[model samples]
Target: MGKNIDDYIDKGLKGTPETKPSERREYLSQLRERIILALTNGQVIQQKPYKPISDLMKRYPSSKLYLDGDLDYMHLSKYIRIANENNIPFTIVDDKASSTNIGLVLANPTAIDKDDIFVSREEFQRHL
Candidate 1:
């Protein structure tokens, strides 16, 4: 049985002819061209719009809002604007001590501290 298996493997290996250098090169060139064409004419991917945290707050009014320390400024600004407009209170807490500029927007008048700078929705609109 071992001898028969060995003969079968040898027959299978010998049946396929090795590709010539020129033929191999031409085949590779064609594959490269196809890949380049596919890449150049590829479909344009569309990104979904960013959903602000304030939108979520509107849906769930009592939900606690916690912004990540590493979030993009533009995205954060959108949430801040929405929160400010709707009088939704939000706290920006950073677990990392290195992040000194953690933003905290308080809509509730009672929660305001002496040191905290108060900015009304009208002021935010004027700046915009």
Candidate 2:
């Protein structure tokens, strides 16, 4: 894998795919789009070149989802499904409360709640 974006940007991460701020946002935006489209279509959304986020969501219930740190869809989907499976609960703060600070939060991974499965990032990013 390429170096994480943060690593190259400022020695903050430890992975490949070093991405510029705008690049990461744009890439994440694209992913968020794919996920929402898949969910609406009731089809499986594949995170091409990476893990599939939809696959994991399909396995969970709807709770136990939380958006805190930056997370890719592939990983968030798993976290959501697991929460649903375990009946755990979480929530996604408003985009205003997001750490991305881009006026747009792409969920890298989003938060989930018992009654509300945060469709914010995917849902919101969809139209963007």
Candidate 3:
């Protein structure tokens, strides 16, 4: 037989390439792993999606999360309490209430202050 069981044993072997190929898959996998690690360590601060109420339970792992919108009694009254209990900072701004009219901006806090939840025309515009 030209081929035998031994020939098929190295099934995991990939074809040898003639030229240098892009490491796209490897790069993407590394990036994904880093993201998951960041999230796991709380190094990756999170935010709700642009529209529709974003699910906080899955990411935050606690009630500490903010709901965007002043107009929605749902956001202000209910979610704020959850954030309070969860130790998550919450803010209400122009963006939360009127998403298309204004967008939201996320920030990390530095010296002299806790992380800020900034929402304003100037801040949102500057982010753009």
Scored by TM-score, the top model is 1
Q: Backbone clashes in each candidate structure, one number apiece?
A: 0, 21, 0
Task: TM-score for candidate 3, please give it.
Answer: 0.26
State candidate 1's TM-score: 0.30
Tell me the tens digit of each residue's lDDT in model 2 across 1-128: 36665457655354445435453443233233222211221121323211234344445434123343344455346445544555545443333232443221222233332233223446534533
TM-score of each: 0.30, 0.23, 0.26
Model 3: per-residue Cα lDDT over 14-124, one tens digit each = 543323222212211112212211111011112322221133333433222323342445324543554454455655543322232111212122112323323333443
* Clash pairs for candidate 3: none
Error of 1 at 64 (Å): 2.9
TM-score, cand. 2: 0.23
Model 1 ranges with Cα > 4 A deviation: 1-55, 97-128
Regions more than 4 Å wrong, model 2:
1-65, 97-128
lDDT per residue for candidate 1 within 1-128, as digits (tens), equals 99999878987988754545342233221222111111000110112112333454465454333343344555555555665665665554444433322233222222222342333444433433
Name the regions of candidate 3 deviating beyond 4 angstroms: 1-64, 96-98, 101-128
| lDDT minimum window of 10 residues, candidate 1 | 37-46
RMSD of each: 23.7, 13.7, 17.9
* Highest-lDDT candidate: 1
Using lDDT as the yardstick, the better of models 1 and 3 is: 1
Write down the lDDT that model 2 would get.
0.35
